[model samples]
Target: MPPRYSYWTIILNGTATSFRSATRDELIPTLYQLKKLDPKAVLKWFARGRLWESPSEARAAAQQRRSRTRTGAKETSRDRNWRPGGTHRDPKARTAERKKVTRGHRTNSERGRPKGGKVH
Candidate 1:
C-alpha cells in the first residue's frame, strides 16, 4: 500500500486536483514541466495563495510574504491624521498652524488681570 502522506492537494487550471508525489521537491519540477507543456496549466501554491511557474519563484514569493508579515506593519490605522510616511509635525503645515496659535496667544496673567479685576 502507498503512503497517504504522498498525496498533495494542488490547484491547476483553476481546478482543485491531487497527485501523489514521493516528496514536495519532486512535485515542484513536475509542476514546472506541466506548466511548460500547457499554458492553461497554471500551477498554484494554495498554501501561499499564488501561482508559480517554477519552484524558485514559489520559494521567493513565500519568503517575501514572510518578510512583510514580520515587518510589524499595522493592519489598520489607529491614529488620527495618519499618513503612511509622515509624522505629526509636517514642516510646511506645522509653521502655518504655529502662526495662527501664536498670533492671538495670551498667557494666564496676560489673559486679563487674573480674571477678577485684581493685580497682585
Candidate 2:
C-alpha cells in the first residue's frame, strides 16, 4: 500500500525510530498494531523531526542541542551519555563518542609527566 503520510520520527522505550505514518495521531495505534510499542504509551515530540520517549528526555535533548549551538563547546556531559551499552540519555546513537582515543600512542616527554612516572 502507498504511504499514509510523509514520515515520522518516533521515540519509544528510550529509543528513537522512524517510519511513514499518516500523522502523529495515527502513529500510536499503528505502533501498537505493529508491536513496536504498548498501546498506552505516550511520546513527546519536540518538532516534526524529533521525538522523545518521555517529556523529560525531550527537554534534555533540546537543551543539549541548544547549548551546543549557543556556546559551541567541544563537548558536554549530556552529549556523551549514550554509547551502545551506555544509558538511555540519547536515543539516536549506540556507538562510542566521536573523540579520539590514545590507546597506544606515545606522548612527548615534556608534556606534563614526571620522567619515570606513569601518566594518568
Candidate 3:
C-alpha cells in the first residue's frame, strides 16, 4: 500500500503540534514501517533531513535510534539526584570549622612552625 503521509508532513506536524499533546514517539515506528514498505521512502526522508525538527525531538529520536540499533539489553540508571551546582553545602567549610574548633588546643609550634618561634 501507499504511504499515509509524507515524511516532511509528519516532521512539520510534530514541530507545529503542542508539546504536551504531541505524540512524538509515533514518528519512529511510522518511519520504520515506511522503511519496510519502501526503502526509497526512508532514503528520501534522510536525504531531505525531514526526520526530526526540534532539538528535543532530535534527542529523543537519537535515543530511540540507538536503542533499536543496539542488541544487548542493558540496564540504565535513572537517578536524577546527581547534578552539579546542587551540592548541599561546602564540605571544606565543615572541615575548616572542625579544625578551627580544635585549633586552640595546639601550640603555636604545632600549628604553623614559625621560623622565629611562637608568637606570644
Please tell me which model should have the higher TM-score, number 1 or number 2: 1
lDDT (Cα, tens digit) per residue for candidate 3, span 1-112: 5533323323232243211213436565665665575554322222124444454566677688789658565555335554446574555777887887886666667778
TM-score of model 3 (CA atoms) = 0.24
Clashes per candidate (backbone, < 3 Å): 0, 0, 0
lDDT, ranked from best to worst: 1, 2, 3
Q: What's the TM for model 2?
A: 0.27
Candidates ranked by TM-score, best first? 1, 2, 3
The window of 10 residues in a row where model 3 has the poorest summed lDDT is 12-21
Model 2: per-residue Cα lDDT over 1-120, one tens digit each: 764322444545656556444356767665666454354444444443555444466667778878887887655454545555546566533333332233444455746677877877
The TM-scores of all predictions, comma-separated, are 0.31, 0.27, 0.24
Which one is best on lDDT? 1
* Runs in model 1 lying further than 4 Å from the true structure: 1-13, 20-39, 42-45, 77-120
- Model 2 clash pairs? none
